[model samples]
Target: MTIPSVKTILYATSLSNHTRGVFQHAIDLANVYQAKLIMLHVLKPLSDSNIMAIQSYLSEKDIQKIQNVANQETKNTMKQRLADFYQDEMAGKNLPEIEQIVVKGLSRYAIVEQANKLNADIIVMGSHNKFGRSSATTRKVIKHSGRAVFVVPTDG
Candidate 1:
């Protein structure tokens, strides 16, 4: 019998403050196994209500400008957070391949799709406490991806 080893890890983040623990888990596993780490953040598309509200108050050009600005800000925020995570948790250490990915879509589908694209061996993510142990995104990923997932408790 042959044991399977990890080669790629997908670290899915909601970009919430609670994700530090989850990211740490991913980093540790990747370093231990010398696996590539793929950091992913999925942003949900604007809801119809939100779009209608914006359209009610702003012109089409104005809405486009606002979206552009928002997109840039989100990218900047992700970069800064990635740098902070690396510095705070893994400063001056040799690690495996690391990539940052940010996309606008449903979190569950996005995470599963990205993980499949990277052929990830495992996924690490943050979860709520026992009370809300399973989030919709987490559940969906588990159900559809058919991949191993390690969910760290963010409430702790």
Candidate 2:
């Protein structure tokens, strides 16, 4: 039997208060396994109806500009979050190499898609332990992902 090796880890975050704890777990696993870590944040795309409503009041060029700005802002926020994580958690310590990205889609699907795209060995994500149960989204991501999922429990 061949034992599975974790060479790449996909860490999906909602960027909430619980994110830091989850991220720490991801980093720890990467450190132990000497794996490359990829941090992903999913943004749900605008619904068709919402896009139509906005389009009614704005030109196509204006809409494109808005989308560009929104995407840039989200990328900026993701970078800052990573910076804060390193400063607050790692300090002067050199962590395993990490790549951060933001993509648009439904949360659960997007995470799985990114994991597949990156060919990640395992997915590390946080599950809100509310009422002694994991969050539905966490369950869905596990259900949908073909790779191993390491869920870190967090207080929401």
Candidate 3:
């Protein structure tokens, strides 16, 4: 029997308060296995109606600017969270090599796509209990992702 090796870890986050615990778990695994950690946040696309409404009020240039601003905001939030997480959870510890990215798409599809693109050996994420069951995204990722997944139980 051969054991699987984890060289790269994909940590998908919704950036909720409870995600800190899940992030810690991913960091722990990365540290133990000396794996590079990739932090991913998926931004859901705007609904067609919402897009039409915005288009009605804004020019193409203005819409592009709005999108640019939104993307920048998401990037800033991801950076701030990483800074805080490192300060609180990894103070003085040798932090693992971490790469952060934010992409727009459905959560499950984006996560699975990223795992494949990054060639991640494992996917780590939090599963919120909703009516005594895991979130749909969590369930779908596990079902669709061919890589190993480490799901931490989190509050809804």
Q: Which candidate leads the pack in TM-score?
A: 3
- What is candidate 1's lDDT per residue for 120-144, written digit by digit as tens? 9999977762244557678778889
Model 3 clashing residue pairs (backbone): none
Question: Which of candidates 1 and 3 reaches a greater lDDT?
Answer: 3
lDDT score for residue 127 of model 2: 81
lDDT of 3 by residue, 73-148 (tens): 9889988998998888799987899898889999999999999999999999888833445789989999999879
Could you give the candidate ranking by TM-score, starting with the highest? 3, 2, 1
**lDDT by candidate, in order shown:** 0.82, 0.86, 0.90
Model 3 TM-score is: 0.93
In the predicted model 1, the residue pairs found to clash are none
Query: In model 2, which regions exceed 4 Å deviation?
Result: 1-3, 129-133
Q: How many residue pairs clash in each candidate at the backbone level?
A: 0, 0, 0
* Candidates arranged by lDDT, highest first: 3, 2, 1
Over 19-104, each residue of candidate 2 has an lDDT whose tens digit, in order, gives 67888999999998999999888888999999999999999999989878987888888788878888888998869999888888
